[model samples]
Target chain A: MDNIVTHAPDFFSNSQAEATKAIARSLWNRVLTSVCVALSLLTLVPLVSIIYLVLKNGLPLLSWSVFTQLPPAAGMVGGGFGNAVIGTIVMVGIGLLMSGPLGILSAIYINEYAPASRLAQAVRIVAKLLTGIPSIICGVFAFAIVVSTTGRFSAFAGGVALAVLMLPTILLTSEQALMGVQSAFREASYGLGATKFQTIVRIVLPDALPAIMTGIMLAVARAAGETAPLIFTALFSQFWAKSLSEPTASLSVLIYNFSTVPFPHQIQMAWTASLVLVAFVTLANITAQLVFSKKH
Target chain B: MTEDAARSSATQTPGRPDFLTVRNFDFFYGKKQALFDINMDIPEKRVTAFIGPSGCGKSTLLRNFNRMNELIEGVHYSGDIKLLGQSIYNKEVEVIALRRSIGMVFQKSNPFPKSIYENIVYGLRISGEKKKSVLDEAVERSLRGAALWDEVKDRLHESALGLSGGQMQRLCIARAIANRPKVLLMDEPCSALDPIATVKVEELIHELKQEFTIVIVTHNMQQATRCSDKTAFFYLGKLIEYAETQKIFSNPGQKQTEDYITGRFG
Candidate 1:
C-alpha cells in the first residue's frame, strides 16, 4: 500500500516562496503557543501568592493553644480562636444541611420532571441570578429575615445567610451534574418498568452522585470562607456559643473583626484563622475528590 | 417453519390468538410523521423482527408498544394498540405498569453505574421487593437467563460499568428480564457488538423467546433472518411486508420486500 502511494509534486517539494511562508507560519504558531502557556500560568499567580502570604503570616501562630483557648481581650498576646473554629463548623454544617436537599430536589425537578416547561426555565434563570448576587446582600437579606423575627444576631441567622449563599451554587452544579448523566440510563430504568420518579431516584441520582457531591463540597467550602454574611448575622463573639440564638464567633467573622483591631495579637490570630479556613476548605475539596473517584 | 410452508400458511388464521394487535397506528414527532398506518398482530412467545433502513421508524413502532416514545418531547400517535385484547392507550392504563410487562434493550448497552448484583435486582428493588434471599435468587436467575451467570458469578458485587461491551449488553439483558416482562422489545441490540458477541446475543434471543414475546428492530438482514420467527419489512415509514420470518426472507410477497432482501435498494 505504501509503495503504490503517490504525492503531488508541490506536496513533498515546496517552492522557495511556499517554504518561506511555511517557516513564517511555524514561527507564528510557536509564538502563539508560548503566549497561551504564559497567560495560563499568569492566571495562577494571584492564588499562589494569597496562599503563600497566608501561610507565611499564619504558621507562626499555629500552636496547641489555638485549638484549646478562647480569643483574648485587648492587649493579650497568647490566645486561640477555639470558639471561632467551632462556630464556623456549626454554621457551615447547618447551611449544608439546609441547602443540600433543596438544591438536589430542585435540580431533579428541572432536569428530569419538568425540563420543557416555562416554569423550569424561569427557575433555572432565577438560580443563575442568585449565584451572581453578592454575598453581602445575602447577609442583609438573612439579617432582615432572622433579626426582624428574633431581635438578635445568632448562629442560626449566620447559617441562614450561608445557606442562601450556598443554595445557588449547589443548585447550579447539581443541575449540571444531573444533566451530565447519560439519557440511556434513564431509558434503561424506564424500560425496566420503573416510574419516572423511580428512574430518577434509583438510576439518575446514583449516576450523577460523583458530580453532585463535588458541587455540594464546593458549596460547603464557599460557605466556610464567607466573611461578609457572617459579619451581618453572626457578628463577633469572644466566647463559645451557648445557644443558637446567641451571637456566633465564626473563623471568617473573627478574622474580619480582629484584623481591623489595633491590637497586634488579634491581627496575628486573624492570620491564623485565615490559614485554618483555607485548610478546612482544602480538606472538603479533597474529600469530595475521594468520594467522586470511589466506584459506585 | 419452512419458507414454502410458512408462506403458504400466511398469518392470522381463524382460530389462532393474537397477543398484541396494532390497527392503523400512525406516529408523529412534532409535525413530521414517523410511522404511517401500520396494522399487524404479534404472536405470543416468538421473536418478531422489524427490518428497515435507518430512520424508517422500525424502532419508533417498537417503542410505541410500551409507550417509551412518550419520553421524547413533541411525540404523538393515533390509532389503537391492544395487548391481550385490551386497549393499551386507554386513560385507565398506567404507563409504569404497562412498561413493567414490556421490557426494552437498546442498540447501545446501558447498565447502571452500579454493581452487577444491583443492576439485576434494580427492578425488583423498585417494586418493593426487600427480601435478601429473594433478591439473591433473582440476581442468579436473571444472570443465567441472559447467559452471563458463569462469566460474572464470582464478581457479582463488581461494577457493571467495568464489564466488557458484550458482557455489559448481556447485563442489560439480564436487568430487563429480571422484571419478568411479558414482552421484550430490542432496538438494534447487536449493532454495536463484534461478530462473536453478536452471535452470542442472537443465541440468547432465541432462548429468550421461549418465555417472552420478543420484538426486535435491526439493520442487519442476516440477523433478522437468523433469529426472528416473524419479520416485518419497513420502508420509508410504511410497512412494506410482514410475514413468517422464513417467508419474508425466502418468498417475500411484496416486490419492494424482495428488492430490499436482494440488496436492490433500502
Candidate 2:
C-alpha cells in the first residue's frame, strides 16, 4: 500500500472565544436564578407572615363550644360559631351544585366541540371579562336577580352570588387543562374508529379529568372564602337556618360582622371563625391535590 | 408451509379480483392532492406493503379503504373504492362497520392509560361484551396473537403505562385485533422501535396475516422485502409500480422504482 501525507488544520483545537462565552453563560444563569429566588421569597414571606398572624390571634378562641353552640347575644359572655360554620358550608355546597356542572359543560363545549363560531368566541370573551368583575359586583348582581326574585336574603341567594364569581375561575382553569391534552391522543382515538362524541366521553375527558377537577377545586375554595357575595345575598342571622328563603350567615360574613362589633367576646368569636374557614379551605385544597395528581 | 409455489400457482389460476378494488382512485386533502389515479386490487387473505418516501400517500391510500378520510375536515376523492365488490363510497355503506372490519395501527404506539387487560377489552366493552369469561379469553388470545403474551403475562392486571415501548406497541396491536377485524392497516408499524423490537414486530405482522389481510406502510425496504407478498411503490402521491414483492425489489419494471431502489433519488 502507498501512503501520502497532506497538511490539515487541527479542528479540535480550543478557542478563547468559546471559553469566554461559556463563562458569560454561567454568569448569566447565576443572575437569573438569584432574581427568581428573590422574587419567590418576596411572595412566600408575606403568605407565611399572614398565616402566622391569623393563627396567633385566632387559635386561643378555637374551642369545641365555638363549633357546637349558637352565637351569643349582646352583653353575653359565652358564645359559639355553629350557625356561621354550618351556614358557610350550606352556601358553598349549594353554590357548587349550580356552578360545577354548568361550568364543566361550558368548558367542554368551548374546548372540545365548539369550532371558532361567533357565539363561542363571544362567550369566551365574556368569561375572560367576568374574571375582572369584582366579588362585590357579582354580589349585587345576585342580590338583584336571585335575592329580589325570592323577596328575601337566603342561603340559596348566597350560593347564586358566590357561584357567579366561581364560574369564570372554573371555566378558565378547565379550558386550559383540557387544551393541555396532546393532539396526538385525540388523533389516536379518532383513528381507532371512535366518533367525535365517543372520543370526548371516553378518551379526552378521562385524560383531562384530573386537571379539570383541580380547577373545580380552586373554584370551590374561592366560593367557600367569598364574603362580599354572601353579604348581599345572605344577611347575618344569629339564630339557626330553617329555609333557603330565610336570611343566613357564613364564616366570612360572621367574621366581618362580629369583628366590627365593640364587644370583646364577639371579636374572639370572629377570629375563631376566620381560623376555621382558612383551615377548612386549606384541607380541601390539599385533598384536591391528592385526588387529582396523575400517577403516570 | 413455506407455501411459496402454492401461492404463485394460485395467482396463476386466479379467476376474479379480490374484494377491495381501487380503480383509478384520486384523492386530495384541501387543494393539494395526496394520491394520484391509482389502480390496485387488494386480495383477501394476503399481506400488501406500501413503500415510498415520506409524504408519498401510502398511509393516505390505506385510510381511504374504509372512508376514514371522511373524518378529516376537508378531503375529496374521485374514482372508486370497492369493499367486498360494493363501492365503499356508496351512500348506504355503513362507515362504523367498515371501520370495525378494518383496524388501523399508527406510526407511533398508543395504548389507553388503563390496565393492560382493560386496554385490550376496551373495544369489546364498547360493543357490549359483558361475560367475564369471554372477555378474559379474548384478552389472552389477543395478547398471544400479537406475540406479547410471554412478556406481559405476569402483569396482565397491571397498568399499561408500566410496559416498555415495544410492549406498548404490541399491546396496541393486540387492541386492534381484539375486535376480529377482517383487514389490518399498519402505518410504519416499526418506525419507532429498536432493531430487536423491530424484528419482533415484523414477525408478529407475519403471523397476523394468517387471519387478516394486512396493508403495511414502511420506509424500510428490507421490511417490505421480508414481510409483504405484494409491494406497491409510490412517489409524490402517484402509484408507480405494484407487483409481487420479489419482482418489485429484484426486477422492478419502472425506471423511477429502479432509481429509488438504486438510491439515485428518494
Candidate 2 stretches greater than 4 Å from native: A1-32, B1-17
User: In model 2, how large is the Cα lDDT of residue A30?
Assistant: 100
lDDT of 2 at B46: 75
lDDT for each residue of candidate 1 in A97-205, tens digit (9 for 90 to 100): 8999999999999888898789889989999999999999999999999976899999999999999999999999999999999998888888888888888888788
Off by over 4 Å in 1: A1-22, A294-296, B1-17
Clashing pairs in 2: none
TM (B chain), model 1: 0.93
DockQ of 1: 0.71
User: What is the iRMSD in Å for candidate 2?
Assistant: 1.9
**Clash count per candidate:** 0, 0
Q: In terms of DockQ, which candidate is strongest?
A: 1
